[model samples]
Target: MNILILGSGGREHCLAWKLSQSKKINNIFAIPGNAGIAQIAECTALPINKDNFPSILEFIKNNNIDFTIVGPEAPLVEGITDYLEGNGHAVFGPSKDAAKIEGSKVFTKKFAVRNNIPGAKAYFFKKNDYEKAKEFIEGLDAASYPWVIKADGLASGKGVLICNSRHELLEALKDFFIENLFGKSGEEIIIEEFIEGFELSIMCICDGKRIIPMEPAQDYKRIFDNDKGKNTGGMGSFSPLPFVDNVLQKKILERIIFPTFESLKKEGIIYKGILYGGIIIKDNEPYLLEYNCRFGDPETQVVLPRLDNDLLELLVNAGTGNLGSTELAWSAKKCVCVVIASKGYPETFSKGDIIYGIKDYSNKSDTLVFHAGTSMDKGNIVTNGGRVLNIVSQDKTFNGAIEKNYNKIKNINFDGMQYRNDIARKVAEK
Candidate 1:
């Protein structure tokens, strides 16, 4: 089968890498893929964001591409899945209506509230509410420090700010409303009471009817280790969190995950594709942080490698309603993923820095490198975006899985490559 994947991040690289290993696959293509992906799949230099959809439709028709998978949020928000399938191509992301689950935090808050899903209480605001927002923050002086302020729309993953004090929250809001840190994305805002807990990403495949959920993975979103600094796209992750035991997983499914699907169903939107449930697990109770319409990035690097099932088959079956009878399989091995990010990331970061470790991976059995932001600079691979690569390694033990991989990370070199030192150390410390 011929397959086309959208976006050029680590998630796409992992999906491409995994799908390429499928015995049933004939050919695979990545739209504007990075250097690492070019090694496995046919990297089509099409701008997947804008003009490529029309070209992609024609290419799928001409090449007999059986399936198309979207890897990022932007195209999905533009209804790329609805278009591809409308033009007789199969896509693995949600429709535009379903994509709203991720595209707009305001929309997600409304949907969750309407459906009675458990989450932090939040209030929305427009640009005109700057004064009102100031008053609200001042009133919250009696509450607690570190208020959570978020852009109502998508500003990548860094749009959510966890401010430490009323002064800091006030400053952040000023930059957002006045300095335009996120432009129109911050035109409207959602201020919520901060929820402190361990965050877990639970992703499930929806076939527009039934759902096939995958293993839950935990991602460290803060830029620094020990959960410091601002939120980034994500710094690192690990799979099958020992924290998400059977009891907690069951409760989360019943409280947040099931009700989410029900709400979308009530709207007549059949969510076919990945339903990403971001849960803040605290006090052994799960609170919904957010929902992503597709798979998580670095989390995918760790999780997909442990998938013992045919990925392409699962995606097609999910799109076709055959998933109801199918059961997904996973490897017992523990997977750990560490992201190599550009220096000064989640802020000002330089690009075009030559990265020199794509081929430096050791001869380890369960190791794979998935590129997030890299390009071929006349032959040498170089950084093109903030978080560049996902270094993944697996083992029977979680500690053995991550430690082995992070040691190899030191061998790799780039001008401003920055990564978290403590990935899965929480589990390690335990």
Candidate 2:
């Protein structure tokens, strides 16, 4: 089958890596794909932006692209799925309207509140409504708790603000709204009461009716250990968290996952593709923090390696509206993925630094490297984005997997490459 995968990042790379293993796949094309994806599939520089929708559609029709998978939320938010399916094409992503669950934080928050879905209370505000913002923030400070300020629209993944004082929060608002740092994404904002707990990421596939949950994975987004520093795209991740036992998983499914799908269905939205529910387990309570329309970058890297089913068939089923009695299997091995990034990430960082050692590092040990934020400059792979490669390793034991990945990292090198070292240390400590 001819497949067109959209977006350029580690998540796309991981999907390409896993999907290429399926014999059902014949020809695969990645639009604006990174250098790493170039190894697994034919990488093309096809314009995937909304403005280039006609060209992309024409290419899709002409190439007989049997299926299309969108990797990032940008084009989805811009209605790429709606356009393609409207033209009678099969696209593997949510429609623009369905994507509102992830596109607008305020919208989803209101939905959760209306449905009585367990989550933190939030105060929404428009950019021009400074008085209300200040009033809400002051009330939060008087309550004496850290509140999370989130840009209601998509700002990549760095739009979330966890502030200790009202001053830092108000300053963040000035930078977000007045300075327009996040562009039109900051046009609206929501201040949520910060809930303290371990954050777990749960992704499920929906065929507009049936919801199939994948194995839970936890991703570390902070730049430092113990959840400190600014949130980057993602630092590292591991699959099959030990915290959520069978009972906890059942509760999450019954309370949050099942009700959420029902709510979206009630709204007449065909909730297909991936739905990421970021849940915080506070005092043993699992509360929905936010939703993402597509797969998480580093999280996908770890999760896909554990799948024992044909991913290509599963994705096609999701797009075609029939899951086809599919049941996913997994190995007992735990997978850990560590992201190797540029020195100054979630901020300004230089690119084009030549990465070395990967040439002799493929299929080595339990570690598999998927490239992100990289490009083939002539013949050498060089940095292209903040996080460059997701180095994944697996073992029967969780600690064993973490050990293998960090040890494998020593074999790969690039100038000014930065990576988090504290991944899975919590599990290791016990």
The number of the candidate with the highest TM-score is 2
> How do the residues 1-430 of candidate 2 rate in per-residue lDDT, one tens digit apiece?
9899998998998898888888899988889899888887888797788999898898888888899999999899899999999999998889898899999999999999998899998888898898778777766645566888899899877788878887898888887778988888889988888898989998898778788999999999888777788878889999889878998898888889889999999978889999989999988879999999988888888888999988999998998898967888988889998888887787866688999878645544578888889998878999988889888988988789888888888888998898888887777636
TM-score of each: 0.94, 0.96
Please list the C-alpha lDDT of all candidates, in the order they appear.
0.86, 0.87
Model 1 residue 207 lDDT score: 92
> How displaced is residue 343 in candidate 2, in Å?
2.5
- Candidate 1 residue-wise lDDT at 19: 89
